[model samples]
Target: MPLPRTAGSALLALALASVAVPASASSTAAAAADVRYVALGDSYASGTGAGSYSDIACTRSRNAYPALWADANDPAAFSFAACGGAKIPDVLADQVDELDEDTTLVSLSIGGNDSGFASTMLSCQYSTQSACERALRTAGEYVVNELPGELDSLYATVRARAPHAEVVIVGYPHLYKEGGLCLGGLSSAKRTAVNQGSDLLNETIAGRAAAAGFAFADGRPAFAGHEICTSDAWISGSNVHPTAEGHESAYLPAFSAAVSGN
Candidate 1:
């Protein structure tokens, strides 16, 4: 499903507005004050299909995990720097200027795109199942073997910009389980491999983020056995995005993790 255009613009406008927050306010606040958060990363971070458009720019939706986190903060405390399709390079290149010394918490979900997961899924529509399987494995390899260095650099950049903040790296949701949900379309063997590969990707991400002294919010363990194919699914919207309830499943726990430093 396509994202709402109005939502994107609103978020962008909000980002521009946040650029000018008086540093004195964010910097000198009580240590226990609601954090000045900066949400960063890809589509999942933006809460695409998770809720209503947060009134800012072509970005931040009221229902977005970032905004949800902020709204539930007793007061709206964070400023979003997240965009639906952001890449590691984008974040490192000063694209999210809202991040600065005052940012108290930073949460981002990325790397899936870097592994070409979207395009691979698209290709699977036309290619043979075997080809898709290979692509999925390749995607896992890219995330595990190559994406870490990039993630390390991105995390370093954020930590450098906001030295006082506790960073949180949110991992992607599981895309499949053995045999999948598509009723006999894919073989059990293939589904098992796909899920296993996804595990590798998430493990790699969690390990790297841990090494960087950031909390890793892994959806794998929490959402395990509850992948899209399961009853009480943790993701919805035809496998691309989470349903409203799915958002709670993914982000609510993440929010708890953020508060608890998990």
Candidate 2:
């Protein structure tokens, strides 16, 4: 009862076609299809100065780094919960809800707002030198003494909510080039102090992120030549927030690299 030669060959081909796809190819496809992203934190994350506000109340900008990332990668889902003026408590209360066990990626830039960064900057720009110094001192103290605990709590909660997510803690940039010159802005001494504060903040945040097993995207190096007082500044003068160029050129690359394990 032997089959004819051509008929037997056709049966062999049919059996080969029924085999499952290779494991490597299947895993790659699953990874590509499972990117559920959630962005959380404050104005820096919300792209307040980058404009194109999607939510005016929260100042959520379409030019934000998270939005840019989502547009480029086209994640399975994206939740932009970062808001202007949000502090750690605010994020814990309002933003963490966006994450769940299904979330695969999360990124945020916070701690600056909680450190009274706005008030300190205003004092440096408009108030007396002594007053500015005092404000910087106060903010620095908070960053050292209080911000760590708050960050730890927030990071822990984020982990609990999105147990499988790859979390990235993005850091703030130095507002001014240390020795760069500008005719009518903060004094050299004030600029130096502000940059020091930024360094301290970034260090603290990076350390906490490491302890929590999260990636830290240090924005300082990326923004080095593009700070507020540069001839081609990436930060807006009005609120010290990153311009659209900054988000696209600086934050985007730094964040993208961190996510890619580079």
Name the runs in model 2 displaced over 4 angstroms.
1-29
**lDDT by residue for model 2 (43-97), tens:** 9999999999999999999999999999988788999999999999899889999
Clashes of 2: 0
lDDT of 1: 0.70
**Candidate with best lDDT:** 2
lDDT (Cα atoms) of all candidates against the true structure? 0.70, 0.92
Per-model TM values vs. the true structure: 0.77, 0.89
For model 1, the superposed segments whose C-alpha errors exceed 4 Å read 1-34, 55-59, 184-187, 237-239
